[model samples]
Target: METSKVIHAIYTDDDVLMAAVKKVKANKYHIGEIYTPFPVHGLDKAMGLAPTRLAITAFLYGCVGLIVATVMMNYIMIEDWPQDIGGKPSFSYIENMPAFVPIMFELTVFFSAHLMVITFYLRSRMWPFKDAENPDPRTTDDHFLMEIPVSGNEKELHDLLVETGAVEVNLVNNTH
Candidate 1:
């Protein structure tokens, strides 16, 4: 694949980064990516990203967990091995549902937590032994990096980024 040139704008503070993002968007420049040491509030809106649907997936996973717990408990305690407890031999699941509430709640929470993590990892293309995609290591510590694609106007973009409180600006040829 052919390599593409991108401009990397480094910022020291997240507030300056946020304002720069807004200014860049207002000027009709397509931002490629932004790397930050921590999550910045309202940054997604500024970047024009769509809302996440992870909560809906989590709810569906929790529902699946609840159904699995209910069915497993009913099969084990009622169908396969019905035991006499508290002088009652009622082999019905409804009558014993109160005793299974804790299990159901725990399984729901467990499934939601685990499945959400897996989903997030897969969606973000993260896996064990994967190479890091960050261009600057400082972005993981104290600096924020913003990437903008170069479309034959490198000097103009560079000057604009420098005017927007960027500490340093570098042109990078990214090859994947």
Candidate 2:
């Protein structure tokens, strides 16, 4: 496969990085990725990224958890073996729903949290024992790295990044 050229621009401060992102977008340059030590609020919006649909997926997962809890409880307490507790016989699901509320709530939270984490990992190509893909180690601590594909106009792009307050700039040949 052919290798592609890219530019890595390092910024010391997130404020500068955020401004640079906006300038890059205004200039119509395509940004490959950005690595930051911590979450930078509004960076996604400045990068023009699409809104995440993770909330919708979490809701669906919560619903699945609720259904599973309901079925399991009904099977165990009513269908398999009915028992009297607190003077109420476990012969119906509706009458016993109040008691199962805590179980359903717990399961819903558990499924939503676990499934959301798994989904994020899968979508980001991150898994246990996976090698890190960060181009610069400093980006994981104090610096922010912004990657931009080079489409022959390397000088212009480099100059733009420098003007945008990049602390350092390096040209890289990226091989996927």
Worst 10 residues of 2 by lDDT: 82-91
| 32 Cα displacement, candidate 1 (Å) | 0.8
lDDT of 2 by residue, 53-82 (tens): 989999999999999999999999999998
Per-prediction backbone clash count = 0, 0
TM-score list, all predictions: 0.97, 0.97
lDDT of 1 at 96: 89
Please write out the lDDT profile of model 1 over residues 1-176, one tens digit for every residue: 78999999999999999999999999999999999999999999999999999999999999999999999999999999899988878579999899899999999999999999999999999999999999999999999999999989999899999999999999999886
Off by over 4 Å in 2: none
The C-alpha stretches of model 1 lying farther than 4 A from their native spots are: none
